[model samples]
Target: MSRYEVDKALWDVYRDASAAKQYRRDPVGFLAPRDLSDEEREALAARDVRRLVALGSHPFLTYNFALRLAGGFSMPFVQDYVGQLQGLVVGDITT
Candidate 1:
């Protein structure tokens, strides 16, 4: 059941080419966190794949926002989510 919903939401979200539009290269707008269902969280946890692969597929916005967060930006609720998502990919300088 969890996997079903995860697959469904991922497919639904990814199938749209417009998902990229949300990034817009605006660090403020792009790195905001968002609510997620259990499936969504689990899906992200299961893989390091970029959720915004349909977007510009770059990490600059995420990386910059992470630096700001580390420097003590007051993150909105959405930023928390973005942090988690970005953390999945950004932690390994060794890689």
Candidate 2:
């Protein structure tokens, strides 16, 4: 019910600093207005990249979101993103 919304949230989290701040401050509040199912809402609130991918969110979006969560794109944080994505099983990102 919320694949597109999930991707949109990820894109916002990646591109908009204000959105990122709001998301970091309160993810459930940030997502409250979106057309998200409970599963999608919880995954976004949790910043669960693996769950996002499994739900068909684009890898680029999830990767960038993970980078932001790790506090930037340094190699160490990128590695942490990679770790967060471990065991990912991407089915189809096309919504």
Candidate 3:
């Protein structure tokens, strides 16, 4: 499956409060049941935002997930996402 597909599946889980709770409680446990590749699993486990962005994960969903993972709306999380997005867009433009 494509990275986008993998990200969408993850996003689906995050979008649900119960599931997101479960995931936050034990990310590895939550992902253990899914048929994700090692890279995907690692990225989620590590909360590697850059890798997720590189994988074409939805930006808004990623931002939301980051906010949730951080336990609330946080400036650092927002800045991190904005930086990543700027990099992505700038790279696209330069290329």
Per candidate, the number of residue pairs that clash is 2, 0, 0
* C-alpha TM-scores of all predictions: 0.25, 0.89, 0.72
The lDDT, on a scale of 0 to 1, for candidate 3 is 0.69
Rate residue 2 of model 3 by lDDT: 51
Error of 3 at 92 (Å): 9.8
Highest TM-score model number: 2
Residue pair clashes in candidate 2:
none
Q: Model 2 — which ten-residue stretch has the worst lDDT?
A: 86-95
Error of 3 at 83 (Å): 4.0
Query: All predictions: root-mean-square deviation over Cα?
Result: 12.0, 1.4, 4.2
lDDT of 2 by residue, 1-95 (tens): 56778889999999998999999999999999999999999989998877888878899888888777667879887777778778776776665
Candidate 3 lDDT at 30 equals: 80
Ranking by lDDT: 2, 3, 1
What lDDT would each prediction earn against the true structure?
0.38, 0.85, 0.69
| Candidate achieving higher TM-score, 1 or 2 | 2
Residue 66 in candidate 1, Cα distance off native in Å: 21
Prediction 1 TM-score vs. true? 0.25
Task: Write the candidate numbers in order of decreasing TM-score.
Answer: 2, 3, 1
